[model samples]
Target: MGRMGRIIISVIVILGLLALGLKGCSTTLRKAVFAKAMPGSYFAEYSRIHPSLYQVSGQVYAFEKEFARSMILRTPDGIAVFDTFDTAHMISLKQTLEQEWPQESVRWIVLSHNHLDHIRGSDVYPKAEVIGHKDINQLVADWPNVNSDIASVTREISDDQTLTFGDVTVEALYMPFSHSSTIYGFHIPSDNVVFAPDMMFVDAVPPFGFPDFYYPGYIRALDRLIAVNAEHYIPSHMDRGTRADLIAFRDMTVEFQGVVEDEYLKIDPEDFIQGIGMGDAIKSAYDRLHPKYGHLHGFDAMFVPKFGRHFGGTYLGY
Candidate 1:
């Protein structure tokens, strides 16, 4: 190759290495580090058991799979499901759907995001029309394994979109970069229920160091969810909650993030490499936030890692 061509390739290689280096310092990396030190309980990674179905008012029911939750709405034409949670969870969900309403087939599988956790196993309902945000297509190209692609999704919700069939209307509002770049928070106006994936916790603390959460977008998304005035709030990671519970969690998370951000900003950006002021930030955040949020579920468990997320976010400029 020519000298100029070699130079260009070298620059690309250097940039790629730098990107990888930065990613090594990400929340996922930190979580992994902690996991090794404090090895967590072992469980079936793909196995789901003792699935419980709760009637959330009328034809709308919530299927809680171990930890993740999916929603089912029975309509005159067919049933509509929000999120599949992977094959094992989907299989149970499908069984419950068939048992409750034998005649009605699942017509629609509305996904929360393109994340494998939420979008997997749509093939369990092959005939059902799969839908997600316009950004869903990015996974088609980005996911390395062609087999893992969300290939069933044909319908894409680009704007404030709604799917209506037999008195059930599921409105999806795209909240970009809140958690996933293309996650859609679903609101069922008639049912007064909202299915927001990983945005807010009901009474629990933020897990995995707020992984993939873009702070600014996350706050805006929380506000959007609160404004919905949903009587029932179903976060994927938690069971069910009321609008009051959702508001409480939202306020706590916002305040925690704000304090962490302020503490981190106290340090100069250039001196971040040494992390000289990090100890003070941690102390200040703990002192200011612990009194208010300590009683919340999993607060003691997730306190340290969750608070450090903002500093990591700041360093990464997310």
Candidate 2:
């Protein structure tokens, strides 16, 4: 390896050892790799944000609290919420909801998936009926806090279903095994808006390859999302989205998978010494991909780690 590459590896190893476990090592390495890879800022413009409560269409609105975002719609019945984003953001989120549509009551909340971060904070709307996929029926029943009184899933959806409340009709698209089996996308026909988790990042790579990610499942779910043709898409993590944004993310995923597979196939078993070969392979993939996707947010810091994750998963029988 060249001096620059060796220096990069050394910095990552030192940071990894000092600050984090294998996961921390990945996080630490992203910044270092991005710094060395370019002269300009490695972080993408889209990665930066000014969190706020904003409206997308007439009644469809979104509130951003730190990294958590919630999509709210003002309907005839009351106000409908997609996901809470986080329990920690309850105070701020509730305030935003009240301030934006004070007259409207929080009638119901539909969970995009069962991930704790997105599903928490339903207690803020005590009267609101909590809705989730049938997959999480047992999960909701078991959770002490939810089933008791403050919050509980009053209704459950098993497959693709439509809900007409107020003036809008919401279509729930069941997505299994993309990010998780519990994921469901809610589509509003009136506003041409869709809300869900694991759809796609706005203009950046995902922080990592999650343990539950199934390549075939992601592809299938993504294709289904495209067919829905909602002009606006709200991923719980980042609410600002367009059809182009999702398409770009899907393209990136397809390309990333292809490139990683080709690189993995070329890795010589003999080069496993000192972990040199694996590192080089990751670097090679980075070099090839950066020119195309480097402009996206977190590409430098997250690209190699993601590549490592997908490649590593291959080893574990992905």
Candidate 3:
């Protein structure tokens, strides 16, 4: 064969290899996108026990109680428990701890927020030092007819702080006005897990309108959580979640917010109430996003009335 013929054969071989490589790359990308879009339901094996315990990582375990969840970290120093539920639930958790790991002592009690449901059982762990955001004290002080002793017990934390015990490090990040002004999230670097209470919901949609939530701040908090890049993301209310779950929730929230804002902008503020009542405005937003998010739990029944209407009103200044 001539020199030119050999060169042409070499070029053809290179082209064939390039096409094969591109085919493999395309297949991998498609699989990744499909997995992200259709994540498996993590709540399929959700525990029903009052205070069920599941190991989330080597030294980290999750204590779940129906809708409320907490984290238990076992370190060389001792054990750190986060967010004790109501009094009765706390008792059950304590009993479980005693039964399973009698040698382990509760050295620290961490609060995700000052919400009553999350902090009511703090008193149960008498020996443990309670930790929470500094604003938690002020929230307790403002409450009427409630015991002020909680403020006295809590050791306030700043915007960002870390508690180290042996090889384990737990970082608490304060996210103001996310769920509430006093909320914070806990990140455990060793376990690659983040405990975010009320910051994001997994396997379910938020009620119609996020009552008492600062919408923009909530989105920011969610963004912050995603940036942590944790392997497992656990929300207080529901099951164990992955990074994909959090991203999905964030995308849905941003989409829903856009729908509400777009609808509100189309209407004049002066005739807002007269043109479309709060309920109708909420319905409009819900209708727009339903096809994309209709599969989420509470999309039709709870989310529209409880969260959507309130969210629309906030945007419309109603």
Candidate 4:
């Protein structure tokens, strides 16, 4: 081979190797996406907020921003908690509840899902009826880390099950898995308030990774929520929002789905690693909503991998 030709060949080989190395570095397993700890910020701010409750009529109270868990107490009956906090947070929440209404007892500890942070405080309400989606029951029964204390009172709730305690009515709706396999979105029909955890997540767009895996279902779940026509919405993570917030979330998910569908139609999955590919609609929606509603700390890390997964799984079901 000629000297010039040999050098050109070597250059191409070097470039190929460099590209492969860069690709390897960006994959999901590389720990490329992670959120930083706020260090007492969430708790401190939450504590100062002084949990506010909105009575949606008929013994139903929407407890706003309280100790990790927001509750709905049915006066003259018992209390039903939406989502409980971590172990320590649960204890604190219980104490706060007692301080506010010492006479009332938490009769039912209903979970949005079996995610650790949400159900960590299950031990607090000893006699309370622990309720969740059937999947949640499976998760606990098959959990790698089972807390015996919390498992005793657990009960699996079917889709569209209604729990009525005196004047209060809490409805559980089954939502497809996004963060965890077993998840449910709760709705209060009387108050037109929906208690959706990660599905209608209030904080951070949720740890979205696989579009084909579970995100499409996430979008569908929102569609169902919109069908509810709930006037008021309570999210698990961030602050309570007006109907506009729910609309925005629904719109964003649609835009996100559109981007995934477009890419799936236009490109080969293998080319996904070439670069970031967001369509005009997706980019516009994300750019507008992210600053105010997005989880800034998590976006930089989680979005790319999530995109990558969505790319690969475009045709393949997750």
lDDT of 2 by residue, 156-255 (tens): 8877888766887788888776777788877787888877576767777776555568776887888888888888877666436787888888899889
The whole-model lDDT of each prediction reads 0.74, 0.72, 0.72, 0.60
| Off by more than 4 A, model 2 | 1-10, 13-51, 140-150, 268-277
For all candidates, the clash counts are: 0, 1, 8, 1
Model 3 TM-score (2 dp): 0.78
lDDT of 1 by residue, 1-318 (tens): 346844754565455445546653566655544444341321232134358888886767888876688888878888788888778888888888778778879888888887777777778887788888777767656766743524557887776787786688878888876887778888888888888788767667766576878888888898899899877888776546777877887788778878988988898767667768887888788789867776665565466678778778776777
Candidates' RMSD to native: 11.3, 6.2, 17.4, 9.6
Ranking by TM-score: 1, 2, 3, 4
**Clashes in predicted model 1:** 0
Top candidate (TM-score): 1
Between which residue pairs do clashes occur in model 2? Answer: 30-301
Clashing pairs in 3: 207-303, 207-307, 208-303, 208-307, 208-308, 209-306, 209-307, 209-308
- Model 4 misplacement above 4 A: 1-58, 62-69, 146-149, 176-181, 208-213, 268-298
Residue pairs with colliding backbones in model 1 are none
lDDT of 4 by residue, 1-318 (tens): 346744754565455445546664555422322122122333343465455556654555665544343656565677777777565656666776788789988888877777766776677777888877776655666766654435433677766778776576777777765556667777777766776676554433445452324766777777777778887666676556655677776675565556666655654446644643444424554455446544432443345455556545555654
When 1 and 2 are scored with TM-score, the better candidate is: 1
lDDT of 3 by residue, 1-318 (tens): 346844754464455445445765577655544443232332332445356888998898988876678888988788888887677767888888899899989888888887766777778878888888877767766675764224234578778888775568888888876787788888998889988888767757764355657777888999999999988888787656788888898898788777777766677777775755555666687678867887776564345344455455556553
Report the Cα lDDT for residue 17, model 2: 49
Ranking of models by lDDT: 1, 3, 2, 4
Q: Give the worst 10-residue stretch by lDDT in candidate 1.
A: 37-46
